[model samples]
Target: MQLVFEVCEVADGNPVSTVRKVFDGVGGVIGRGSGCDWVIHDPSRLLSSHHGLVGCREGRYFLTDISSNGIGMAGSCERLRKGQARLIEDGDVFELGALSIRARLMEPVQPFGEQPVITGVPIPDDAFLALDPLQALDLEHQRQSTSDELEALSAGVGEPGAWADRHAADREQVAMPRRVEPANELPRVDSGALASPSDDVFWMEFAAALGLDLGKLDHVARKALAIKVARLFRLEVERLQHNRAYEEQVRLISTLHSDYPG
Candidate 1:
């Protein structure tokens, strides 16, 4: 099974909320305890070091409460009692004291001993956008991992610079402004103006959204993320185009219905 964690907000610590991590493991821990798999470094006294345990077994995933203070689900104020294990559903939000996290079951596990096959299905750009923004950025980074120096401004915007969780200190500066803070709040974008798909301004804004500063990176480092930036831009442009096309079609249908009356 594919599991995804989106850090929606960071009430404390580094801005890890900008990150999205996917795992295909059998099980793991999410707590502040030293032995826990996912260690949380928060100053809140409400959280137990070992707050929760997560495991995939018997063909299903589950989360068990092991904290004394209790973990509360966002929509419901009900706090799970200690040793209460519940099946994890898609889009489940849990509040571990001050740290808030959302878990999603991304994909079901394929039965073992069965050969996997590729259907050659063409996935739409919107499908990717449905993913967590950080996840989308990461996938684009992987796809462009081997890209060399950029031949176009649209070619980059990734690499280890502004968006990268880990950035080198001495790379040449091409610093883009720091637009986003926590990374969860996306800024309003004018898709029509970004139709070029190869514009520097478009890429700069995108990198900013991803928590990357284009102006802070050195010339060499900026060249590194060229492909990913362009890829994200292209995807966004296509999504916008698709949206516009759909709107136009709807308007035309409405006009025809009014004038022709079926």
Candidate 2:
């Protein structure tokens, strides 16, 4: 069994419509800082760099307040003082700064054939864009565990600013002037473009509507189609992190998968 935390919307604390992201391991710090286990990108800046720590004790989970602003229960007006700790149960919702998050214990399952595994080695910039999207899909699925994904991104991306450069370059080519706020709404993409959908269901539907047999496509053709899909997924994740779309990010990550026809 693993302890999972579902982060609700940043705009308003509510349950996520999709499966809640499940982070592996016992528990760790929750904050806006990159170093924290749970990195929350809060645009309002209400969350501290090192907000609080979620730790396991006596076979139960506990949240400790370590931030300057403090943490609180979902409906309570009171917040925990720095250094204070509270016992939390599965399905308990709490407030960390402005973000509302729910916690629950879940039995681990391999949604894909085997557990989703992300490679630790960094892919060069030239290769990052060219790498197969199906492989990228596998890595993205493995990202449901917050620590595993962040660690891979932080370490596997080689240098500090390389990831940003790659992202900026991709955006320069396809990004629009204004931003869209809807969680499920996809950005404006060329109709002729390949890999338009973020959800796997949409991918399947998209492939089916076009009467494309993904399994039969040549390697080069499949790679061409999947590259854009990979780019879309990566860009969407970056957008969510930057906008502090916590709920959307969680849903996107937890549900990301490409069920390629066998």
Give the TM-scores of the predictions, in the order they appear.
0.38, 0.38
For each candidate, the alpha-carbon lDDT, in order, equals: 0.63, 0.63
User: Which ranges of candidate 1 are over 4 A from the true structure?
Assistant: 12-23, 108-262
| Candidate 1 local lDDT, 103-180, one digit each (tens) | 888665568867687688674444333457797777678667745544244444533333342234434465867777
Cα RMSD for predicted model 1:
30.0
Worst 10 residues of 2 by lDDT: 12-21
Tens digits of per-residue lDDT, candidate 2, 1-262, equal 5678777646544333332445453556676666655677776778887677665543455677867677887876767766766777787787876678888877677677687787896756565554467867766665654596587666555333545666767767994669767698669864435544564455466554323335444445555666744554465466558668877787676666433333
lDDT of 2: 0.63
The regions of model 2 sitting more than 4 angstroms off are 12-21, 110-262
Error of 2 at 99 (Å): 1.0
